[model samples]
Target: MKKRYFIWFLTGFLMLNCSCNDWLDVNPRTEMKEEDMYQSEKGFKNVMNGIYIQLASKDLYGKNTSYYFPDLLAGYWYKTNNSTENYIMSYLYSNSYVENVIKTIWSKYYTVIAHINDLLENLDKTDVHFTNGNKELLYGEAYGLRAFLHLDVLRLFGPVPVGASDGTNAIPYVTELTRDPSKLVSVTYGEVKRMILEDLDRAEKYLAADPFMLGSMYDLNNPGGNGVNYTPDDDWHYYRQTHFNIYAVDATRARFYQWIGDKTQAEIYAKKVVGVKNTDETDKFVLATNSSYTSSEKGALVMASEHVFAVNCSDLQDIINGVMITSSSSRPKLYLQNAWISSVYENPESDNRSKGGRYFQTDGSYAYYLKYYESGTIAATDMVPLIRLAEMYLILIENSTLTEAREYFEIFRQARGMDFAISIGDETARKNQVEKEYRKDFWGEGQMFYYYKRQNKTSWSIPQSVTIPENGFVIPKPKGQSAFE
Candidate 1:
């Protein structure tokens, strides 16, 4: 029997808008062989762009990983009238609804990883010439994306790290394009960690010449920036932040290092991202100012300025509408409790991410997180933030000296409109304050659950007092997988 592969055929590939090179304007296309797909630079670009579109699908970051499932597990939303939300937020992983969600996440994530592996395999062996550093850009993005996807998989499915010797079995680190079942097997946590870091190292090396590192010509917020329009002559590297550019590489490194308790490496990479500068020495990625929270015309909700890596989800408005808004109140849906809103942002009047602020909308009984809502006025606002500059600062606060931590903390505080600062008395005080910040910072982004899991928190009190299960953090791998799956 002929063996089937996981690679999507070029006939099923995304149709390109050759008129302007805008990736978001994809349509259906005709068939081409795998060889023909990679015979030119545009083919490679299409494949890469297809992978991103897949990532932004509802099955992945666009809904589950970015906000819905993860945040529910983190206890961000109340179990309003939705039974599935109730089960997930309560950590009833064995429930059929929650189980289906887990199964889908596992299946979709690996499918995307397989596609990435196929792209890398073809990219390295092909003799096609790439112009203006596009080759390096593509290579870096592939490697970085592989690492990024695997790391998130590990975080979601792997055991919580205790130390270097925590030899528990973790998810498979798939690096090859094969449909063979025997090739897929779980490895130790340490092994997966090592593989992820190795890929990141390669990504960093290849991305060294990334346009983001070279100059600010691709700056999205700048007038006449390449992101403004994708002309036929324009290089595809203008929206560096939307891709896994070098700073994203560093930010991911910081996040992974922090996950493994490697404070030294974590701080090193965190500071690197924090220190990013433009050609004129202006801060390349800085904390969001108060205007970012108050400006209703812009995407004040998502805070694009601080985003290190964000996904341009074409379905963002749809996701927001499905989860947070509607014309009729007859449907039971996902929403935050009034208590959660008040508890997390205790000083609601002062904090821009609080109840009275633009980050949430109230209906007298419940609050809706507005971070993912689209403004329609700015094209840049329609995104799901995967990583942000504020998180880099939080990591520094977690790993830096008390004085240094306080400085970063104060800066972040002022940016969020807190405008208050106090000296930390000791390590314990610093740790407590950082935890509070985490609760306030990552409301709908799906990171609060990871924070709780990382800290091994057993009990929480935001919406109400509840004890987390010991195995709650370890999401079970879907069972009955065939070789192809």
Candidate 2:
């Protein structure tokens, strides 16, 4: 087990850049011992921020997992126009390019997991005192992130549906800093599910105690009775939306329950997020408006308010310019299937999602996502959204009765400038409608593939008459990991 874990550690070291001069940098693991790194509260904060920085890298949410790769697999993009692009669209696991992509994803995620484990293991021993609830906040973020990363890994690399009785091997849910190879064994899909729920449960407990969730009295800027006079620099509470706050944890619960086929539990959690009663908690997330996308500023995007958890990525523009199909450049464009666009955005003029949601080239031959659009002025704090309230509504609709589902769906549709009087015929029609909305809403955000997998859809249409294979449902465990075999 020690050797197995060590192999992963080495792989992470080789694949990940241990040093960056930017704010995201974590001193190379060699320079700072684990004990020294956690000796101060500032050190703990650095590790937490570093994990987000790494997560925002091109390898994970920044590209492969969200914006670029999975969008193609989900049938959102048109057929490939080049060999390298073909590797992704075709789900070509045997291709060396695809192999390296999968390996990087596996190693990088475990790398973050390892760092998180180190934090959890050493947190109790820290000599640093955390006043103003910093300790709880740090721990809450750590646990929530651990669950978040592991769940995404399971979604991407673990078995589909995650309730398989065939005893298919799933990714290991590493919860400790293991030097012992014997402890590095992988868990089954069901076991991982339980472990994730356990982590989220702990996260909820800790995050519920967070100052940011305590009400207006705890607002960092207001500092009400606390009298801390907390500035933005001193107040980590200022950016609760960026971290996995309590609501985000609840939203995650909704997602987890939906994944495991527990509709009752899923709907309960989703309602907590949607805040059907219009409680203070739900005010944290507001639906995006037309100006949200059309405006040039960072927070202008209406979906920005809807984000429950996001990672700040200063280099987002560079990533978009390089890969996306912007009007200015088409070197490595990602084209949308026209049929899909028409199916989802039937009433383009009234649909805010179509009229001012994601941008398209003037020729209308391809559409480019503006979800991550940020200007030079706002570049300092650009974020990649991970969880949001819209997803909660989707989860509720997915598991509800036709009438109930349509009610939830109409709320979302009307918010996006569509008619609220729309109706669905039956359960099948409702399901299809729910799916179309997901494809429309989460186009570039990277939820489509997982959505398909969760539904256990055997086949789907992409452009150029291509059909995703059954084997394509699960990315094979990276080569040479006999444990995954």
Candidate 3:
């Protein structure tokens, strides 16, 4: 969910047969032709679906990447976790392997940009007769999605702004259709942000309200944490992986504003989400009870009240009803870090109880719970959560004062069965505790890293611990010249 790589896709499309990272062959099908791709409604649908398939690759958002600090900050991953050591090694050391992934991600993101550029250019050229609502929404979605990818990468690699339009630089803005991305010069990060904001501004006008706007109990009570819930409304909507809507725009705005340090905009969108409270609990989105999902399952994407955006994972059903583990060291699968697992074991007891099994204990530490790949038999599990309803609530909590923090904190906490009523007056204490819960519940979900960077808090260290990274809370400019050297 953290990474938004489109490199495999770029290579697949460009090299035609070159094996880059992971993705299928790039040969054009008999049905596709340069001119015919946008000739009809079916062609349009086919193009969009292809975009989704490429976009949804594990590299893009399915698998986390270094260009994304949310994973780094979230503390869900560490340099020492056993199940994910190979993945963690290069990241911790900034080695060539991690660099290749970053390079691929950078390339793929631009490819996506190129593809969007082509779509927009061609779509703009066509005088298509369309049903009133469909064309606008679809194009708006296309723009929004394109902007989302562009903005996300910049957030991780661009430099901070200290002056005027001469802001810190960014990776090249791959906004034009091109066969040679390497020749492109990088643009200013501020410019990229400006364009992204502009796109979202257009998107804001075109997109509709949250799809799950109808009141439901599941929406109101969907947060799964104790002492202060975040994104309560997002919790209400539920549908595994699929298309994004207005909430996606809202959440992205909130997140983007938060990154640029525009707390007002952040708080505004955060509040807008909160205002859409869900009255009925039954409508809350959860794992489809007793239903096995396939690797191809688009995923039960978040509905209005459930989530804003999420990673469509290959769940266990692809491995035949959970008989085989999805994330093996070989083929691999999305997963929670062991530290993540270790932290969620909230009920480790000498005496066994129904809920006790949920908690894990290793000598002195508690554990976390993940329903995916637990027995090593889970060859397929599709539970990769990206941006959920809980995020907004946490954003609100972060927006609160010390006294106000406890008020909302208790509201969120009580929902998750934690009895601790928080009302701390210390700013430092409030930030720390709020962050702790955020880290604990939102781990494998992929929000941990940014929360840390946004608050100017410490980065992840070891389990049951935290450390402020000396690197500061800025995603440094891409390594160039001597740095990339």
Better lDDT candidate (1, 3)? 1
TM-score of each: 0.90, 0.87, 0.70
Better of 1 and 2 by TM-score: 1
The better-scoring model by TM-score among 1 and 3 is: 1
* CA RMSD of each candidate after superposition: 4.1, 4.4, 8.8
Ranking by lDDT: 1, 2, 3
Worst 10 residues of 1 by lDDT: 10-19
lDDT minimum window of 10 residues, candidate 3: 347-356
Global Cα lDDT for candidate 2 = 0.70
lDDT of 1: 0.75
Best by lDDT: 1
Better of 2 and 3 by TM-score: 2
What's the distance in Å from true for residue 339, model 3?
8.0
- lDDT string for model 1 (261-319, tens) is 89999999999999988767878886777676555435566777787887777766766
RMSD of 2: 4.4
lDDT of 3 by residue, 346-441 (tens): 331221111233322122232323333333322322535455656666666777555656766666665444543445568777776667666555
